[model samples]
Target: MYYVTKDLFFPPVSQANRDGILAIGGDLSTERLLLAYKSGIFPWFDPGDPILWWSPNPRMVLFLDELIVSKSMRSILNRNVFTVTFNQNFRDVISNCQNVKRNGQTGTWITNDMIEAYCNLNESGIAKSVEVWQNDELVGGLYGIDLGTIFCGESMFSLVSNASKVAFITLVEQLKKENYKLLDCQVYNPHLESLGCREIKRIEFLRILKSE
Candidate 1:
């Protein structure tokens, strides 16, 4: 059962009873968004779709220390192919992710409302971006929310070959530097598996959310 907020804008669904949906139809206010993140829920919906929240059962995450840089990737890193930065050109990073054409995607989930919401989060110091640049141009990057000791990676895109990988690798290295414990990837994919993401029960994930 989903519980509606006093304003009839937000839902109060139990984390354990997400039903693959934590909430529906709510404005992305700072307070509400913060509360949602604290409870391991996140908003994900299309432009015309109502605000849909999700909290999957088996959470996918990557520990900074557990990142696996394959031999080939290691070679690329060794050659110092691309340079990376953090919290710089966040809007550009997300814009690229949203507009870049992919193999099987017709459009992006990063609606204009979503962009404004996240940019607000960034201004409030809750969300951030990692950028990969070449020849002083933004080639690839990723965006996410950064809790005290956790980074919830949302999405990434690459304009040049392996550019996204470079951005992600830089993010992990920086996380290690900051002593961050985990990078929440949200879902499982072969690419993430190759980069060392693993699955954990939601209960355990919530514990980390609390501890972090």
Candidate 2:
């Protein structure tokens, strides 16, 4: 376990523990966050805990071509039940992600500091948010770092059924149209699995991240 310092550097991802925790205690400065994402690491820790950086061995990712849009989701997409936009209402999207309750989690990892940091990233065009609106009301959305060809998703929230799914699927479709290479999901979960995200070896993921 490495402890971060004022110097902006991280140990190689190869040194990450079995659980993928690479380092501890680092500020979420835009510079550091950008560097971390480029290096295939991301911050994920409880509110009170020092910032924990992870590079899981089997990195979960979604190749745009492999995205699974279920028949119901396709029907929803065709219905145009919700309007989606990018980089619109980013602060609200992240805040909702912070407050939305999740199963097995007592609190949120998206702390106020995290929100402020990523919001700054958004202002600089390095971070992005996808908003889902219903009748002019923000119902669901997601935010993440955009590395040109790779998008490192951080978190998402939904107030109504399928709202987040709509945001996600729309984002995937847009990325595919834009010729994005990969969507780095960080870790595996059933929710993402249903959307066709799968785990790949960390080395393979790094290769994709570094590829043109």
Q: Please tell me which predicted candidate would have the highest lDDT against the true structure.
A: 2
What's the residue-level lDDT of 38 in candidate 2?
97
lDDT of each: 0.84, 0.95
Candidate 2 on 49-127: residue-level lDDT in tens?
8899999999999999999988998998899999999998999999999999988988888899999999999999999
Best by TM-score: 2
Q: Return the TM-score for each candidate structure.
A: 0.92, 0.98
lDDT of 1 by residue, 141-188 (tens): 999998878889999999999999988988898889989889999878
Which runs in model 1 stand beyond 4 Å of their true positions? 1-19
| Residue 129, model 1: Cα distance from true site in angstroms | 0.6
